[model samples]
Target: MERSLAIGPGCRAAAAAAIGLTWLTVAPAAQPRAASPFRLHGTVEPIRSQLVTVPRLTGTGFGPLIIIHLAKPGTLVKAGESLVEGCRAAAAAAIGLTWLTVAPAAQPRAASPFRLHGTVEPIRSQLVTVPRLTGTGFGPLIIIHLAKPGTLVKAGESLVEFDRAAQIKTAHDREAEYRDFIAQISKRRADQIVARGRDETELVEAENAVKTAELDLLDKDLVAPIVAEKNTLILEEARAKVAQLRKTFDLKRRTEAAEVRILEIQRDRALNAWKHSEGNADKMRIASPLAGLVVLKTIWKQGSFGEVQEGEEVRPGMPILEVVDPSAMRVRARVNQADVTRVRVGQPVRVTLDSFPSRQFTGRLEQLSPIGSPSGLSNKVRTFIAVFSIDGSDPHVLPDLAAAVDVDVK
Candidate 1:
């Protein structure tokens, strides 16, 4: 269950305004803004398709800390390696608890249940974003020390680091305490001191107790293959590509699926990894999830990164990547305020990019926003978001590469 992070109401307004403008040139133009000075300001926003912002990896409960060390920012390691040395003590606990009783299979889908289609990943939850490590307490996470990005790490080798001394101490402590608890339970059972699992509450309590103890171990360790290697690569590429695609989709996710959003390079990487890595998760990692040569997105910004820096901490869930699975690409642009009434789904469209000043792409109106509003930069003009899939492939065409689109409302 996760909160929906759709484009905000404000962003939607700007989008609507843009869509409405597309209609201004059609049928008959009774009004020509009458004047440019009074017309609200408008931006040629290259829309963004929906993004499956990767979820932050987090711990379940305290446990035997597992620490994996990497050599650098983006090191490639093999599965079954000790990123941080750990065994699934907590996982074992969870498994043991499951032996208690089988829960019903009818549990409704979790509010944010994983619904992966085409290539977009499920809402990330099973994977938690690990926090920044600063030589913390006894619990150790596998911290890899990579010499640099793409460094090849060996199978079962220690790539990520861990505080061995602290982790060892905790693990030993847990072992001793667990043994003591086991002894106590055995004694109680021998004397028939008290009945256990006699009531629902008792069974529930016992289950929780086991889970807590086990999670302590699970949290400390970093397990490999958190997700399948193929899927992990797809996710990595999708995030890495968002920066470029940001201009293409202009924040309208309804028309495009997440699978179509990974940058071209990343998609290539995924393809390569699948061909090689024998399906390894650690085989793919872009240099700093925020940067890859996203020259394509700059066209829409009139500059690269739209004033955002490589090292800046972006708001969580921003389209961190821009992808071009061209077969799935769409021209999602904003129509200006005075033209909202003229836009409609299935209306034919013509799009031309500033980068491709000589070329024009065609598509039909796939969607129109219900409301129109101002752009983020205090613009007087309003807009609506509209989307249309590209009819065919263009080698030079790219997401957010800028285009001049003419929609045929007729």
Candidate 2:
């Protein structure tokens, strides 16, 4: 209070500085307190199934150590190999790779109302006939060689040959006759030539005798008148003789020429006969007119069914074989009268061969028989024939093969 104080601006500044230093030292020395720890208090609870029972594992050999290896759906498996392992009961139940085999799905069924059984046949076929042998007098010619059934032949190919023994003999005989006629004609011509020359010489001698008698008449003029009359009579007789000789020679020449003409006619006839016999021999061979497969025709004789074989005798104009075009084939099926109405021409059809079940063919109904006939054992069961034209060709598609035909309705 009573003290005297001399305070300057520096002294006031030093005192404030000393007060700030003292507060800084005291603040750091006093640290803040730590936070309190949290407390957690709870208990374990039991699990409960709602609206369903949760069963516990009770089977034998099935517990926490249970293990199983399941096979995939498309896994390759061998016989006696494990397919499902783990549960012995399950493994034994499904053993030996028990695969439920199922056949492949069937093809789509066509909208066909009915089917019929039938045989395969050719659409175009020709009958082979035995050639006619004329003027040879040979009947039922013997067959030397015959073509086997199922032989493919072309047009104009030789198919049959008849026995030529008889024909050969006939041809040789006719030829000899022709040669003999030619020789006779030649001989006749030579004789006629010689006979004409002799007639000319005889005519000249008769003319010379007449001339000599007339000269004797000239001598009679030098002698008595009675001698002249006798000479004239002798000349008349000689002239008459010459005239008779010339007439006789003309008549002989005409007769000889007529005879020669007759020989020429006979020769011509013989030549014609020879040519005819040779032609008959050539006609013994029969040729095909179309290209196709050969089918032997069935011949019924004496209650036996057979075909023309080699060494067999066949009559002229008889059917020996049939040539069928294998390219165009058809199915001839007999349908019941009740089902005949369902089939129509131009309808699509499905054909299957009994020999080859895997193969299938498509065709169209080409024709339907107008008349119905008996088909079954009883005459009351009548059937109508139906023809189907095949669309394509196959080697296995031959005539008479049993086939099944399915026709599509409408």
Candidate 3:
């Protein structure tokens, strides 16, 4: 019986070991825990990968993140909601004066909601070309004279003034001679003057001289349509010259029977001369061709006609100033080629810009490229673009939002 008990204990232990081994094998299969999900730490953006940029310092993380519109950080902001605060002092001031223009259509058109998923752009191929002013006879400035570098100008403002000092001196000398001739004639008796006929040529020239002085008064007021502020200083000296001429001279010619031909000839010559001078003076008025946010450009080295400063001689057709309207805002984005097939035109999408991280604005797929193109943020394989229209009402959409577009293939 004792032997039997010992064998039973051995049998029990072996059974227990076998049970333990079986339990261990089944536990792994029967009981499982889930793998944790990935948490993406980014501000709520109009796009998935990129940030919607605002003038507000943010998710760019160049320095520290500057939060704008703290109250609605992750909430829906209204159309006029002050989404950001504490911007650069100049930027804030410009908002009132800054204006944006919708691209004028070839046909007069009604307003339509446009699908805009383009880079914040300035030249849209249709903006009116900047005016170029060139002059002849004033003979291309013997010495270069330029307008002020950074002066704010009003509409019909003057930009630069040619040194008319030499012209003034010549006019003054002519006037003195004319006055002397008139004095000489006044001293002579009328019959003696007529018989001599020597002073007739002098008297005619002096009359013409007075007429030229009157023309000078008109030529002096050089004015341009104020294209924008900071075009240059107004042609103050030129206007003053016109004022001086008007204050000093009076010449009236009567159309008598014999002298009519001579008067007509003089009038024709003066009219032609005035036309040329007026056109030349118009060049001095550099006005903003369009209203927009003015950002001074400094990339002149790259074959670009950058911002022109006062005291710089600019030809007509040179871009002296720039105005980018804030209202012309468009959101731009990059998407992957691997996922390119899934994208199509008119796809609905959403965007969250880095500037207003918490804001989510809905968009529609506006454009898809016919051909594949290469992109930096895209995979090496050729990728296609998928543009979506964003809510234009949001002023936060000013520009440069590193936006990602989620195209809903479904």
TM-score of each: 0.30, 0.56, 0.35
What is the lDDT of every predicted structure here? Answer: 0.42, 0.79, 0.45
Candidate 3 ranges with C-alpha deviation above 4 Å: 1-118, 122-130, 135-277, 286-292, 301-316, 334-337, 373-386
lDDT score of residue 348 within candidate 3: 73
| TM-score of candidate 3 versus the correct structure, residues matched by position | 0.35
lDDT of 3 by residue, 1-410 (tens): 22221223234556756544222222345656688888788676432222244443333423323344344333444434444444344344433222212222233333332222335332221222224333233432221333343333343343334444544444454455545544544443344445335445545555555555555445443534342211222334434544554443322122132244544455455455455455544444344444444444343524774654444543334444334555444455555454565666776776666567687777676767777787665455566665566756565664445654445555
Regarding lDDT, does 1 or 2 come out ahead? 2
lDDT of 2 by residue, 1-410 (tens): 35344434445456756544222222455565688888999896535311212223344543322235555543444444444434334443433222222223334455556788899999899888887766746788899988889999999988888998787788898899889988998998999899899989988988998999888887775899988998889889889989998899989989998998898898888888788888888988878879999999889755799888999888888899999999999999888876787888899989999999998999999999999999768687789888998899999999889999988786
Ranking by lDDT: 2, 3, 1
Worst 10 residues of 1 by lDDT: 115-124
Error (Å) of candidate 1 at residue 286 is 13
lDDT of 3 at 96: 26
Candidate 2 residue spans exceeding 4 A from truth: 1-124, 154-158, 218-230, 287-290, 330-361, 364-388, 399-410
